[model samples]
Target: MATCCFLSSSILRHPSHTTPLQGRLQTRRNFSFFKITAIFWGPKKTTTPTTRSMMDVSLGTFTLIGSPEQKPPVEPKELQQVSISVVSSISNVSSIDWDACAVDANGQGIFNPFLSHAFLSCLEESGCAVQETGWLPQHIIAQDENKNTIGVVPLYLKSHSYGEYVFDHSWADAYYRFGYQYYPKLQSCVPFTPVTGQRILVRDAWYKDQVIDMLISALKDLALKLQVSSLHVTFPTETECQRMKKDGFLQRTGMQYHWKNRNYKNFDDFLMDIKQSKRKNIRQERKKISAQNLTMKRLRGYEIKDKHWDSFYRFYRNTTDSKWGQRYLTRDFFHNMGSKMGDNVLLIVAEEDDKLIAGALNLIGGDTLFGRLWGCLPQAYYPSLHFEACYYQAIEAAIELNLSKVEAGAQGEHKVQRGYMPVATYSCHYIVDEQFRNIISDFLVHETKQMEVVMKMMQDSGPFKDGLE
Candidate 1:
């Protein structure tokens, strides 16, 4: 997520928001027992400290609120009756049912690792994104009269807007200026993740549309019920963004650079498609690794050992601590998530003289390689090391996996020159006060226009010979 980068507007940076995010979506799988049993990974469970990460996403229970049977804003007669409920943790819902909605939401087969039950639970259980950290889970769910879970929204009762890439501290401050309390606004996202996907996840069913609309209504209803200032859905799909905007959410846009795969056989094949100058620059940049006497390695799944996680933590802190910011993730998060996610985790490290100097972490999606976190040994600056580790290596891995794209997190004009072109990321905000909503809506209209111009300009100047396809 380029966790240290100051994304969005002034609200994006000030008030200590100057960081990236954790994509906040959720899913689950079947399990043999209840109470979050320790589910070991790999052929054998290596000895490690007992942590929440070992608790597998299998079967689970949920707390449901009593909502009288009602027809939804969108009428699908097939759905007899449905109710929406809120829970404090993803653990309350079965991973299989939660993940079902997460998967079917896209209507495409692409799997978002950040949206998975395994990923979201790691953030919560690791204590990285919790009430103490200002991210309290108030996840919304939809179910039919028969108690079948059909939809889910990963949400947080936010005390501040730090983890969400769609910064709104200015909005918060405006509320303060008006003597309003905005500290407890609602956030719908994967805590600390900025990657784009669905936020209102509804399972593929005859009643899908009704479930989606009802889920949204539930989100707003809960916000109003709690008297929160607003509700925000960050990094949602364009379709979801538009739907929410039409339903009165203020649409906001931001830019991110992503690299696409054209079925390239290899990295060189990918380079050949870009402008010659860009291609030459990339080749030269990649060459710097050998010149620096550094060893580059991309370890996946079981290949990543405890020592690698240990080094990556130091590297991550080296970046986070630079902003005088407290770290969002604990060291235990890496081990717990790594052990659970396995091959889905890609740890790219740079070693010099047998010492780990730097590392970049990526999560494998169905078709996209997510460039998540990257950092190096404090005070160790190697030429082009950041690009090689975070961008080029990500592109290479994407190509190798036959993936469609490489999302290089947030904020870097340099990424454009290296063939990562800008794309619009969408978010929508629902302000409760009509007056404030009108004001922010006007602002969003202008910001969206400006964002379009920036995106068009970036597209025109892309490193690709034919521009973005």
Candidate 2:
């Protein structure tokens, strides 16, 4: 039976063994309006505690009291009536409802294509993210009083962490050395994607905070019930990372290269903002593409034909095979995305003698262009072809579309010289074992410091002109 739970006058509780809170929640109601007063710490722990409040008339009998910095009160075992059911696939949930929580998570009209139903469904429908591939979808769905879907977390019960860009192989090896099994872990992330966005997908309602709190609690409870070694929410937004930290999830920081647009009129306008040497080098590299009789084409929406997807998949497989990387996505995934997402899908193809030799795949967001995959013909090599198709083309497309930035995937310092700057990406982890948690936490502290220093160095070495930083 489906349960319809309400957050009416109920206390939001963290897991029993989670962190402690040093603040209180107060809710006041006047006729139709409900006012919530939340007194908690800010994102930085060293900052002074503060009180923040808001009033919303639409919320009925629910108010949230905790912020990302404050620990939510642990719900008593008796009040754990909120039911969470894990679906084997994302297709079980209707696209309309899932997208409602995804795109409008904050009511600020922010849209992330990576978290949409169409994208996730494509992974499953195409057999890319399934049990056979080690990414068995166990998505957590939460409903409200009226049986309305308020929150949905894209979770996977994984036997390995091949597709997740956040490396956890060391942790697995540690467990194995100690005679502990760590294969079946819970992961909350987009399969093979490392883009930073909201992991805890919740509707943008007045009771959004309460729903998020419930969702976090549910995730921990589910993790324990399944007896997995840990629960991981990777590539979450920085704000989401902080919120999960309050729920006993250890925060992890990573860095990705992103190109931010500054309202350039054209590609030439952008090149002028970078250093002279970088500008000259980029021009030279781009020249290589044309010099080799290669033609670049940007296809979007219906402009991307069936043959385009077929060629792109071959290119994709070629790149993965050559690098000895796992081919996590299937050919059907591209067709599904193109058919469903339409204009949001951007395919940059490099043609030689009218034959598609290479391609770069990207998804358009509300304000950002996400560069996800790139590959070329295994039989041939074109000097600077990868850079042109992936980085340069993405920047040009973002500028033309008036998008804010382009996230060119993960772990590429090479992108730094091509005008992509380093930006911090976040993730949160909940380890079941106390000993492992402590060890990972200490390691994270050092890793974070190192990452900060490296990011600074990358910023200094960025291609931007002097004073741009």
- Give TM per candidate: 0.83, 0.83
- lDDT per residue, candidate 1, 201-289, as tens digits? 88887667767777777777766667778889999999999998778888888878888888899999888888898899899999999
Q: Measure candidate 1: CA RMSD.
A: 13.7
What digit string (tens of lDDT, one per residue) describes model 2 on residues 159-195?
8878887877767765654455777888999988998
